[model samples]
Target chain A: MDTPHPGPDLHPHCTIVPPYLLVRLAKLDDPRFAQAAAAARESLLRDSQIRQLRGGEHPFTYSGARTLPARTPGESDRTISDAGGQERLPGRRVRAEGQPAGSDPAVNEAYDSLGATQALFWTQFGRDSIDGLGLPMDATVHYGKQYDNAFWDGERMVFGDGDGQVFNRFTISPSVIGHELTHGVTQFTANLQYEGQSGALNESISDVFGALVEQHTRGQSSAEASWLIGDGLFTDQVEGVALRSMKAPGTAYNDDVLGKDPQPGSMADYIETDDDNGGVHLNSGIPNRAFYLVADALGGNAWERPGRIWYNTLTGTGLGRESDFAAFAAATAATAAQLHGIGGAAHNAVLQAWVTVGVMTGRE
Target chain B: MKVIVSRSGGMAGIRLTWEVRVEEQPDPATWADFLNSLPWDDVTDSEAAPDRFAYRIRCAPHEVVLGETQVNGPWRDLVNRVRAANGM
Candidate 1:
């Protein structure tokens, strides 16, 4: 026997409902329930492999089926779908951009995040669009069967729509949308190598802005805002509070299925790994904590000073192609100095944030 | 043996790594030309050594770090192993 190739295994970075949850589902007395759960898990694995193999056909690869105004149109904020709509291609669906509100709030959340991110970049960054032109925001809600992760390909953001067993709908929260869109922003700006600490910084920037976008929209201060990313993505079964907690890193969630929140609260426990774009998602806890510190230190609105500093560093500074955590600290400090002043509170905050994370700036 | 061309840095700012098999050890000229033929303008030499680089080109059982200058013996053997593994 060919040692049975172990079939296919999940990629290190792949997101799915915890296998433990599936085991529970598999143990259910109801035959239909157990069978459905098993089928869902199988489908998720298959879909993840399909996504990896497809490699390029990420959802939202196209603009919406129809076009919206170049700027904000007077259209009401609503969700639209192409259910029963004809398929233009194998996976492509043909539906008007403004058909009707999606029944699921998660779907609407994805759309809202997309729209808000686009608007934020246009209004604040003055970038043309996703590509610095008017590249339409494309998103695929309910991507994989019960998939628990959301990601942005080079083109559009694809949401798993969640299996409802572990996660409800990815669209239930705006931060998830913001998180994915900020990946696009990083793509266009730093184009940070998606490996090692550089990759972690790439992820951290996304989380920083992901939360900021929601806060800005709601006009909530850093203290007032939950400062949690993907707050609504996880279901009640999950033991943790949120997906990732910026204010209190590492406390996002802790459960049997997903295990403990792998994120670190400070730099002392910063993780280092060679998998998943060099453990981009893992080490991001460092920068995520840094942003939280800066926000809290400054107090009041996070978008005002802390957000400006980080945004400037990401877009303005020449971040290293393979930057480590230390390089990022230097850049943020420099960015704050350039934006605020040498001894300005913003600059000091950047320096202090790194210290809290166990990394000092400039031989300090 | 198969030679994998895993380019790490380029103008598109993309760290694209892909592998293609080659039969015999190709002529250095042709191989160099093929590497040069990629879209290079979008990338400038950030560190000024070269526009882009293949940090690690793994040939199945072996691997090599292609530096800026002379191809070392270990690097050559690494390529040979890949070719042999691919049964070229």
Candidate 2:
């Protein structure tokens, strides 16, 4: 029997930090931030090269030299590798499934964060792994010389040690790990095109699940959660609480070297530009706030009701690769109404949340 | 001769710019020769990869946008020189 298959041909090089922020970091002339500047420039070059490799007409295919293990449902198999400051992936394997904690802090942190992310999906969404097929989760630490970003290259997650002056280890925040992994989930599900408003929605969906993973792990109510994306990723030297704030956009960071966060929380402040994949990271704040409002209005565990609505909309049939903010809002409201009764608290909450963020759900 | 290059696109979609006046260079003749040797006309417009960087070069009457991978030879050398001059 043929099983339901994931959609065709959409692979995005999803990264936790946007290139614009890195560009600012790269252009800093301050003596104190020189290392960060160099690292950011190197990351940009490497990222560009990787994108070129992945953007060919034919899909990337693996050779037959290596074989993957048989997938076991409901089991999580994780591997953490150490790159040893080289710009290579899945470097020397340092830790594996069922292995004891390693001596390296980065390795241990990556291992634990991967487990947390896996637990969140398994316990809440019934997703065994990124592909829901018990696909082995893998990560690499110490990716490059003072590398300042983390990314999911349509396969495994790669992280950098970061310039100690500006950023910390990518594995420091569990939500970041969840955020990157959710991209894999999206690749298998809606596979939203990573450009313009659709790209913003794609980013918002990851942030929503990323926040939920953190909240679920901490058992925090919607009111109690911080709603910050990369809360602890920034060093104390930077004048920032996190990379992006779901609760309040455009307020995550403001520093002499880092520049101000450009995220817009409402459609009124939406930016129109031809850069950063049409401002995916900047415009994501609108939908991020929408989800936050819905969770706040409903009260209680967000991953249960609000999270379910978002997840259903993501995996549901109506969601297309090019879905924009309005389309997503309507889908969520429809999902809420389907899960709950018409005009129920959940449905009204979803609609009101979208409207509060200046996005019409058209649920009337 | 005066040239301006604007680099945009990347994971974050931010834009960076650099401008150079050939006559103002410490060695004007050397800079002019360097600019003239570049294969500017050969840099064709191409589709950009999602979230990858692209560049726009505006040097007087000629203007062209090239994807990040298409930036090589003199294009890469010029961009690198500008970035180095800016202390990047």
Candidate 3:
């Protein structure tokens, strides 16, 4: 009931790939990965420029003028745009609701991913869309020339054709699409501050739903899931499985060019640094692992019990924008208790998961 | 004189740095002339967007940290020049 009302400056430029990974990519000297390096540099430059522009007065505001047609509970309205290898927002309208599949694979992928994400929220949670008000889902593909990342820019989802050498098209990953859209859900709900612990929680929530969408789409139980964030985003040339792994945090990638995956799965390995907004993407491994533990213990579809507990915590009144790991863990435990029972297996599992991840959840 | 430019903030919260030594440039006089025409001391910090970048420019004896909204005119010009010189 008490949703966050963040100031105008609180909205973050939520991107799927962390900057450290891109920085490592930009610093590579191998000739075979020269294109990847160039793309990384370009993405960094473009990201910096966008941040600068956003800081100015009268930052670009979302114009939610286009409304989707009224539909049944399970139906969705989706639109996919093509940026044509340029840096722009909501580019040329290439596909609309009920339109046949397009020629470009990227366009079709975006459309289908949006539908799948919508279906997950609607069918399982009884929520309509990102805003929980049947908002029209919009996306843009081929955003920039070899852009190395994807982002949710506070308005709509934007995907990029990654450097073919190290990364693939962002639209190719369903979990990634779900991850970006979940930022919208967070924006309208918890509105967590995008720095320090809260930022890490923000990132974790997206990863949670992202993994859930993938598992739901594939009809996989918790035991059958891979628990990877960006499984298909990487190319074969890179010696990596995915961008990040919920099952094994730091074991996702250890490539020479991309550097080691810096995620830490517990508080014992928590890194205190001024970089990466106080390690939002890095420290998120702790909570991610906690979720994985809960899902594994429950032994069924993750979106059923674990998903409900996490989602309730996120949208519940107990959450705050500045909530740290302990606070968030406490909230999840309380939500699990409220949803199940005071001393049920789900609540106990939630508490034990946090403790296993080195986060003390009993504190205030 | 030496100039070091650092950029911080953004979605990733990564900081990027670039430096230029005035004496090492091919046209030191030109560089000096460009630096002299700007009102570096009068510039003030401005409001920054959430998750946006701020810049810190240290020109020998003088240093200033300014948010992206504060960048304009000579400051923007100087940042662009330094970034281009460093091939960033």
Top-lDDT candidate index: 3
> How do the residues A1-364 of candidate 2 rate in per-residue lDDT, one tens digit apiece?
1121222212221112245545666788887666657766776767656447645211111121011234445577999999999877779999999999968988998888888888877776666678654668999999887766677777788788877888788778888888888877777667788878988888888889989989988999899999999889889998989888999999988888767888899999999986566778789999999999999998988888888788778876657668889889889999989988779999999999888888883545
Give residue A126's error in model 1 in angstroms: 3.1
How would you encode candidate 2's per-residue C-alpha lDDT over B1-88 as one tens digit per residue? 8788787644333356888877877788987788788776776656433434668887777777777667777888988776665665
Q: Where is the poorest 10-residue window by lDDT in model 1 chain B?
A: B43-52
- Best-fitting candidate, measured by DockQ? 2
Candidate 1 regions exceeding 4 Å error are: A1-100, A361-364, B1-88
RMSD list, candidates in order: 20.1, 12.7, 13.8
What fraction of the native interface does candidate 2 get right in terms of contacts? 0.18
Question: Each model's C-alpha lDDT?
Answer: 0.59, 0.76, 0.77
TM-scores of all models?
0.61, 0.76, 0.73
The DockQ-based CAPRI class assigned to model 2 is incorrect
Position A105, candidate 3: lDDT: 93
In the range A3-72, model 1's lDDT, one tens digit per residue, is 1112111221111222333344445566545454555446445555654654522211111111223444
Give the clashing residue pairs of candidate 3, or none. Answer: none
Candidates sorted by lDDT, descending order?
A: 3, 2, 1
